[model samples]
Target: MPKSKRNKQVTLSKTKKKGREHKEAVVNTMKQAIENHNSVYVFSFENMRNLKFKEFREKLKSTSRFFLGSNKVMQVCLGRSADDEIRPGLHKVSKLLRGDAGLLCTNLPKEEVERLFNEYEEYDFARTGSSVTEKVELKEGPLEQFTHEMEPFLRKQGMPVRLNKGVVELISDFVVCEEGKPLSPEAARILRLLGIQMATFRLCLICRWSPDDFELYIEGPDDSDIESA
Candidate 1:
């Protein structure tokens, strides 16, 4: 065989092997993300840009939750063959994810997924997607029940609500910070306090644990996760 041809065959084999390995890793991550989850909240940051994306990531950082990897990477992390409709439908969300955009795979109890991303999104960061850019649905439980808990967080987060398309809705909008950086230290205090205060005032997501559960998660949300501050 010619030297160039031999090299080409070797390169091709390596590329194919790498692709398989990447897919397997994605499948595994997806599996690990749902190992103990009650619900799997799949949200796509498809149209996110600029400070909006940074701030969105910062919010997750503050909570010690992060999502990284491209759509292809994530696809491979989650086994592509587990379910038929899921991966393709999820890919549609993943496709919207360009540049720094990503999917958040969490195991913080499926019951708490909506409350994490959408509930407090308006104030924590800007939003660019619409029902068209991204889709929303509850795979389990009553999505409506979460609305009551979510509404108050919206109020505190400084997001605007509109009767978009004849339906009352809390929609995303731009919020530019004063210096084009994250909230100031003072502001961070206020945000944490605001979230905690809102949690207390509304009793939202404030499930009372027994002594054992309390000890298990004694650190609280800010402590439990890697927070921005």
Candidate 2:
């Protein structure tokens, strides 16, 4: 009932809420990354503003398994700031949570990650859909085809791009398509042709739990050697 006691109680409650289910997720992440010895998956977010935000979010959801984690929980388990330790785990999630923000952890392939990203290729819905108004920096890799097809649409947004050194850069920033114009029928068709890479491999989670300091793992046994002995 004392004032100091009451304040301490409140602080504890806040800390509990901030950490929440995050402790459980962090423990599981460490297990997967360190124990199971799975490849750490990181993502990159270029234009996640209001531009077709729902569509963009769905793209992420479909491609990777994301968990909402607390920074305190992550730091305690990671043995460092999430911004640093998590970079090796997830590229895009860390950027979104540079401060006391939410973090998404997963173990998916790089190709599938990009595949899910491009799946929303038609968010704008039309010929110009391939070309969006947002600032999209196309990095070098197998995604050049999609970027090459999107050149015209990028031009419309006043961004001229030409692949140099195997990478494409936007001369200007990308903007959301303005209000009041459904993508032309031709544009929509072009988007379909451009199509999403369509991820084939499903990200199978081997385990999910808590206790950040520890890790998880999986293994198979061979009967041949044992049987011979």
In terms of lDDT, the best-performing candidate is 2
Relative to the unseen true structure, what is the C-alpha lDDT of residue 168 in candidate 2, on a scale of 0 to 100? 53
Give all TM-scores, in the order shown.
Answer: 0.29, 0.28
lDDT minimum window of 10 residues, candidate 1? 197-206
Task: Tell me the spans in candidate 2 whose CA falls farther than 4 Å from its real position.
Answer: 1-30, 33-37, 44-64, 81-108, 118-229
Assess each prediction's global lDDT (C-alpha) against the native.
0.38, 0.39
Task: Give the alpha carbon lDDT tens digit for every residue of 57-102 in model 2.
Answer: 5665643344333555544554443355533433222222333233
Alpha carbon lDDT at 126, candidate 1 = 22
